[model samples]
Target: MSQQEHQAHSLKQHWRDIFQQGLQHSQSRYHAEDFEIEMAFYGDLITHYQSQRALALAEVQKKLPQPLVKLWQRANLANYYTRSAATTQIPLLPIYRPQQKASLKHQLWWRSLRFKDEIYKDLMIRLNRHPQLHLKVLQHFLTESYLYLCNDHFMQAVHQRLQQRFAHSSEPAIVVAHSLGTVIAYNFLRANPQFAVQRLITLASPLPYQAMKKSFKQRVARPTSLLGDWYNFCADEDFFATQPLDRAPFNFQPQIINQTIHTFVDKPHEIIGYLQHPQVIRAITLE
Candidate 1:
């Protein structure tokens, strides 16, 4: 193999080893049931690492000069919104535009104040203590969010995937999207109003957050393409889904059926936990 190809292969092996080691460490920390969940989460990342890594690296290379700046913008847009006007003493804007003049220290302080919940606290601790492992996990989520929101190339790819998936099919399909997938699914259905989606099941969705709502370029409303109800299931402990999609911006015709659930797992944001919920199962399986 060429030097560049060989180097890329070696780097992939290195990350595989790191993720495996992290998985072993997680196994020791959790009980049997929870370990299964952790294993699946990390294992999927490991198994699909090559493809995901390629996609992420391609997007990063294209935006090499300003990738970090883009990440900061996406992070603020995704996490810096208030739940409601009543909850915070300070008036938080629905939209977040980074203050280019703000000092790094000021920005860090601002983020800390906004993200005071236990989930963010726990994640911050993990980020500090186990930077490699935890940062990898955070990177996976953030990369997907950043690319889809900021990169036109990535958006075109998403549209292509949707078209390819449903090109020949005329029947309305049920969509069950988890985490960042929920954001993509919502945008796709909204942008293409002819997709004929029967129902949208958003698990651990971030749609309720003003941060997510404001990030959308289009008007944030229910997808006119949806012919059935929109069932949103959020775990009580899932940091991304602290609120349900029943408020002003999200509230519209064919109202969203928001259900808050509790997934008593070590990682509440994991898709497996959300998928395994009895209510979610029924929502996906029921006619």
Candidate 2:
């Protein structure tokens, strides 16, 4: 590889190490801390992540509009992120059992079938055989609010932290988000349009289009123009994001850039398997 590519790869590995270390530290501290201490720790993490986010954003803004950049830096937006709401636990609903058991032949056939092959076999066949399953899957896609609030808070905290780190830049900011973090990035930019977020990169986001259904349309119908130059990378086999992007419930057009990361031979989502794939590392470091 060229020197630049090697450096980029090194940077990606470094970030992965940092992320892993953060996760380890968090778990250890979480177990040792009292409720108050735990809260304090979370506060610190929020601050740190936000700062990193802001720096990254400012780097992106050099290529964007000034008015938009100003919106990203407003104090009101930061306050929105710092404010806390009451914490309440929402219980997971029980899964319904089918009254009739699968026939031995049917069960055996399904047991032998490959899940990936089945996933793309035929939408109609999958829908017909497991109608309720499909509906429930879609329902799960729509039920993001439980995590949305927390994500929103995270984005604000990141912005505050970023603002301090990248304070010198006058250009519009860029937001790079991965997985569930995409939702947080979206809300942050949407709520702070003045901040001039020039680009948004969403890696493995599960934004359900179905959330915009008649029953829930009102919640997200407002015109919020935060989604610009949005690049959405999805591993075709990353079942986690398949439905969300395809089923999102809004009229907003996202400038989605698709990436296909090859899955492991037999086991996908396993940590080692995920690690072996360069895309996971590449996504974060963008080498």
Candidate 3:
């Protein structure tokens, strides 16, 4: 094979391995100590998804129709960071007590100094044991009965961080959310009117209220009007994303700049294409 062909082959193989490793780690046994490692693995998977998605979205723009291409350019990659709190926590994960919290706080200061030991301690002592428990706990935690608790915790953290960075911002901030993260974003915006996040790009959001809530029939619905520009995209085969966003009880309306629903029949395309669309790129570009 020519050098170019060989390089392409190598790149494909590398991505395949990276995705496989990410899947393995995410599906691996869950235990207390493994939380940090598991989170790290998940982050790696998201990073891979984000980069490959950007590349794929770029390609889709070339092949698809103008209306369809508009969808890819508007999508935003959601980045996640986890922290602990005294009052709130994920339902399944055991809350670290005051002592553990104190210990962890001290370790945070030492983290840059003794990174290796800290990682090893978390991996060996905690991570190796939690995979099974995680499966059971996450199931319950994710359910409606308990989901609000989890969302609340996540929103508090996101807001706290956002405040620290842009507490007195004049312009609206662009907020991108993925999967369960969308719920957190919604709750955060609802909690604070002063926290004006302008544009919202939601990808593969599984929140049942998302798509369906926009109708006038729903008495109770997600408050979509809070954000200025809203764009929601979902893959055809992503069952979770397919959940009916248009329901009843609470009615909702969206301030949509552009929208598209993709059905990549043959295979999943790159997510970045959503961002490449002229409108979306223009909206997000720093310059």
- Per-residue CA lDDT of model 2 for 1-287, tens digit only, reads 01111233443443344334333332332211211110001234433444544444444455444543453344122222112111122111111123667799876665453464334334423333554433333322222322233244543554565445335446654455554455545554555545665555565554543331212212553225443455556554444445434333444455355556544323222222232334443433333
What are the TM-scores, per candidate, against the unseen true structure? Answer: 0.54, 0.40, 0.38
Q: Across residues 37-127, which tens digit of lDDT does each residue of candidate 1 receive?
A: 1010112232333354555755544443355346435555223321221221222111122456778987786556445445463543334
Best by TM-score: 1
Candidate 3 least-lDDT 10 residues: 76-85
Write out the backbone clash pairs for model 1: none
Please give the lDDT score at residue 258 for candidate 1: 89
lDDT of 2 at 270: 22
Assess candidate 1 and give its lDDT.
0.55
Query: Per-residue lDDT for 174 in model 2?
Result: 48
lDDT of model 1, residue 47: 32
The better candidate by TM-score, 1 or 2, is 1
- Candidate 3: deviation at residue 42, Å? 12
TM-score ranking, best first? 1, 2, 3
| Candidate 3, 209-251: lDDT as tens digits | 3322221122444454355656666554333344334443222
lDDT of 2 at 82: 17
Location of the lowest summed lDDT over 10 successive residues in candidate 1: 35-44
